[model samples]
Target: MDISIVLNLHDEAEYVSKTLESLEQAMVYAVKRGVQIELIVVIDNEKDDIGTIVEQFNFSVPSKIIKVKNCSLGPSRNDGISLARGEFVAVADGDDLVSANYFYDSFVFIKKLEKNKDRVIVFPEYVMHFDRFCFITKFVDSDQFSAEDFAYFNPYP
Candidate 1:
């Protein structure tokens, strides 16, 4: 597989469907661009309807749902990543929605970095925050920020 999207779910029954739908669109877009993709959803809460929600979604790529008991986001994400078979891995939250071109755009950027590819991390250039308040934040390239800047503020949303 070229890319594996690991999505962490924790009691996000209200948003999981939309998130999965958005991810499916992204997967389809990437696949059309010749990027093989798979999805791994890690549910940290067994008591919620997240699993059922995920099962109802029609994913375009190979997908799996792993159940865990309250391990929180960090460990749940790690669990999903551990099972990923992709050459490149992308992380997502069950409540979030990404652009349809997200994976394809990232793939194009990664292909540009032919040397030291393993040392690079890809992040979206812009993030749209919603719900209570709405705002759009732009992220610069990693080299533009110093270590101290990261310590004081989060460059990536």
Candidate 2:
């Protein structure tokens, strides 16, 4: 199955290249696993040069840069999704770095499952910074589906 990574960005000129490089690594891993993936970078701010930076990245799969007037996260992501042509959509932040094997691992797990549109799977993330600090956070386990836990969790903006 093909996947589209909707990467949202604001004024991230300094970090765009690094983030995109990390994403490229994930895409390479996905390709090696026999999964197709594309990138749709949404520059939320019209004046941001993040789009220009995205142009420098060499991607094996389809990739595009979109600039939007609406700077909000939700709308920016919505705009990216509108241009997506993949069966599965993965939301990523421009400044965030994911593991190199993220896309490959996720696709492998998903491809083995039965088709169920209602099922949603989320992988845990670790927040990190250049200052050498990291916060590993867990949202849910395979066997744990607690409504009360989800009710209080605000995992995304």
Candidate 3:
């Protein structure tokens, strides 16, 4: 399968190296299971480090790093899309790791989701872990909601 991986990064210099290393392992696993990845890394312009990170590793691997000044998820995702040459794009943060099964399974599931023209997005159900507990929950598409809709919205910030 041919796929594009869009990684959104910002002022995460501390964790980005570990994150990228993990991503490299994940990509290796994906390729072994028949996936060709086009990695599009979109980084916020301020205090950039993605370039250094990509260079620190062996660039013999396939990937592209893009820098956008002060860009957020929406713009970075758009920027990634502009650079993507694959048929489908998978989303990830600069700090998240995908399970080994993610590539093989999501490839099957996302294909079916694409068939439903009415559904612009298909999200996976995730299990949340809090201090000593875990619970399964539905995923949220943040773009579909207003501040008034999310009852559990936190205001601590």
> Which structure among the candidates has the greatest lDDT?
1
Candidate achieving higher TM-score, 2 or 3: 2
Task: Please provide, for model 2 over 24-101, each residue's C-alpha lDDT reduced to its tens digit, 9 standing for 90 to 100.
Answer: 889998888788888898888755566667777787778888778896999999999998888888888867788899
lDDT of 1 by residue, 1-157 (tens): 9899999988778888888889988999999989999999898966577788888888889999989875678888899999999988999997788999999999877878846645678888778886798998998887798889877888786
- Give per-residue lDDT, candidate 1, residue 58: 80
TM-scores for every predicted model? 0.91, 0.82, 0.70
Candidate 3's C-alpha runs over 4 A off are: 48-50, 59-61, 112-122, 127-157
CA-only RMSD, every prediction: 1.7, 3.0, 5.2
TM-score of model number 1: 0.91
State, as a TM-score between 0 and 1, how close model 2 is to the true structure: 0.82
lDDT of 3 at 49: 61
- Clashes per candidate, residues 3 or more apart or on different chains: 0, 0, 0
Pairing residues by index, what is the TM-score of model 3? 0.70
Candidate with best TM-score: 1
User: What is candidate 3's CA lDDT for residue 137?
Assistant: 57
